[model samples]
Target: MTGMEPLAPLATAGRRIETAIIGGGQAGLAEAYWLRRAGRECVVFEARKRVGDQWRERYDSLRLFTPAWADGLPGMTFPAPRSSWPTAREVADYLEGYADMIGGSLWAGVRVDSVEMLGDGSFVISTTSGQWHAQNVVVATGSDAAPKIPEVASQLDPGIRQLHSSQYRNPAQLLPGPVLVVGASQSGADLALEAAQAGHETWLSGRHPGELPVNERIAGPFFWFAQNYVLTLKTPIGQKLRPVIRHGGSPLIRTKRADLDRAGVHRTPARTTASIDGRPTLDDGTVLDVANVLWCTGYLPSYAFIHPAVIGPDGYPTETQGVAADVPGLFYLGLVFQRGFYSHLLGGVGRDAKFIAQLISERALSRNTVAA
Candidate 1:
């Protein structure tokens, strides 16, 4: 009731719709856009008060590696220095703009507490607002809702101001002392660099994937390496030939080695355990003094709220690249392998969304024909 101006939540209830897309990030928003184009009744459920909470919660200095030109929706073009990277704020703004262009039907601030399958083969989404019934549900929240912090981190001394990379913004906000940045992913590297450059004694832990020069780090080489070079590419012969490399242990993006080397960040071995002695204890028993600790470990995909049947044993949705198996009307988008080759990236959302929308359209049409 009273679904008025922006930043307002609609009082949705027991009513049913053709599609209910969860998480208003790129994937959720993209699917909603395409569904609207398909003339399907749909609504977007965003857990955050506003859209793009993920981006907003990220480090203030965070910028997309991909250019703004590659970051636009299907039709809309992001106005900017095409080749230059856009800040996290720009990304949030662009998503908001995309929503506006798609016409604001999204219900922001509505958090889906749980999605349960009803006896009649529909999804009952228990949200912060109320219940929503939908024939199809898309889990587009992506990963990173669950940040994997060390279990030992909680036992550290209270004097240590600790924060995850997700919470880190700028160095000015951190305690004015030495900072220990853990996990040298893109986020970790960027944060470490920012901290070190800010005149703080920063120690970057774990083996960092040193970034190549911008000229050498093009997307073509990256993909080729990931497919042909890395071990993730499972093939008839490649799987057998590939080494057992820990892909999960590294970041998708490279951390510029030149920047880190220039920053003089003390590189420590990969941590086994973290304990607060005089300083912080590593698995190797070496101690490092740190006034602040920034853990950039990684994120976990939390599908705990998803209905059990929809989720497989892996804690991820059981589907062939985002199509739910146990549940007919259930779908997943914006995931790692939802569709196309690049489903998780902003550049891939438009392509994946169109594919999912077409499938939904075809199914609905087929049902209508059968009924007729």
Candidate 2:
């Protein structure tokens, strides 16, 4: 079958393929595009029933920080005004459409369970549907694999409603009293502003990570160029800034601290360290008695499905520019700083995908030649 054709249904037994990509998000879809261009046989397995369900699962009020011009994948341009910031649903629909346009082997609702490298260097992937033996495996799962909630959350009174940012859709999900939003990063600030606007007494705990120095609209092209090319792993400045960006909260993009202040969001530049008498207490000994606690604390990378040896001590894959160092034919995509600062971003991920796809294609071609 041609590369554009849908992958055939697998038998009860293991199905062997040239390449298997895990996660059908932007990264996986980008890789699929390039692989298809190279005439490679591959399959993209996504856990959700439909492509872009991940984006659709986000909060109702969520809008991308980047403009439409910067959100396109590999071949297709985002179908919106260049300056418009697309909503979560818009991005989701765009992704679904991109998948349809690519016309490759995409299997939805199939969750990958495990990825184990055998003695022969081939990977045996266990999935919800069946097993597959792949010569090359690309782990394109993005950074936000699992929601990260502080352990102190368990100590809060069960009477108070608690919702992680991932589970938060609208202010309606909150209790009818004061709302305490923990973590003042992009997500936290957005949620706090929403709660305050919805007429709730909002307390935003955590320091602001600062904002872009200039207006994004005017500096759009320059900023995009810097992020896409300049602030990369290859440069000394980018290397120095990598750890800081990875550990620190992401700087506010669309929402500024002044906006939150105008909305009357009480800003607390301290962490919520404890729960005292069923109330959240700040590190400075201030107690907040709130009916709803929203956690915008962000997420943690989960590599439990992959072999432990391939993962680093920091709980991420040990790879160089998406290629796994420990295992041949094993690669990663959509990782933060995988190639550069924008490696995980939609417009930037395609670059990394193309690089990995080229390597995979070259290796496949070499194998074929040796066999001949």
Candidate 3:
């Protein structure tokens, strides 16, 4: 969809809406786009002061692994060249621009405190700002809510500077000394390389999570292949691999193995398990005397505000393709493999948004007809 399209009207703060979408990132924005397209009155409640604060808050050198053309949501295309990988700031800015273009009921800084289903079958969305009523609620908060720093990290010395991937902004944030980075996934590799390039001695410690078969320079073919064959649940291979992908972290995508080697970042095979006498210790009993540690350990699914039934004991929401079969009118988007592998991605959210929007529209129409 063209970004030039006429924007829908913005929602007034404190007003009750028919549908309430939590989070104003790409997923929530995509949901809002489709909901508005179906003539549904919805309001997006963002916790951050701005729409793309999530991306803005990431590390300084972070960029989209995919090209610009592959990073668009519903009703808008990212404004960068098709093949160019946009920096984190660029992607964040694009999201803000996309929200402006949509102009559809986005309420930034309205953090959702709790979501409870009322006895009357409607939902009461309580936020930091105020309470709002909605016939339907879509949790588009995306997958990354809580940073997954291990409990053992606290055992480290107070003098040592340790930061999670979410808390990391730039190499300058680290103390002046050798840096130890845990987790050998894309984020770990990226941070190690960046630290090395910034003239810091960097040691990357963790199990190698494997790498993508394709190179990073030309991501188009690999993207097409994965989207078509690997990511989709319809395929037999995808069905078999879905469970693995869900449980395991994705292989290195953005950072290549050669890139890390070229940057002179030392690679260690053991994971950093804990600290031994103020020094970080590896799983193999090796203690590292690094001044800084960056935990690229990824995040956990945190939907604690939702009802227990909506979320399984595993902490993940139980839903089928964005639709809540158990809880009618309660849907989810931006979850990993919600429908496909790209469900949490920018381009993929739009497809799920289209499906969820249709379901919501139908339910609303049915209720109106019953009332009539």
Best by lDDT: 2
Per-residue lDDT of model 1, residues 231-271, tens digit only: 22234433443221212333335456776779887777667
Candidate 3 stretches greater than 4 Å from native? 1-14
Against the unseen true structure, what C-alpha lDDT does each candidate score? 0.73, 0.87, 0.82
Q: Residue-wise lDDT of candidate 2 within 1-372, one digit each (tens)?
A: 234655454445377899999999999999999998887888899999999999888999998767889989978999999998889999899999999998757889999999999998899999998898999999998878999899999999999999999999998888799999999988899999999999999999998788877665755665578778778998998887776576554577777888899999999898998999989999999999899999988789988888734677656788888888868999999988787878888788999999999999999989989889
Full ranking by lDDT: 2, 3, 1
By lDDT, is 1 or 3 better?
Answer: 3
Can you rank all candidates by TM-score, best first?
2, 3, 1
The 10 consecutive residues of candidate 1 with the worst lDDT sum are: 241-250
For all predicted structures, in order, the TM-scores are: 0.87, 0.95, 0.93
Distance (Å) between predicted and true CA of 283, model 3? Answer: 1.2
Better TM-score candidate (1, 2): 2
Question: How does candidate 1 score on lDDT?
Answer: 0.73
Error of 2 at 118 (Å): 1.2
lDDT of 3: 0.82
Which regions in candidate 2 have their CA more than 4 angstroms from the true location?
1-13, 219-222
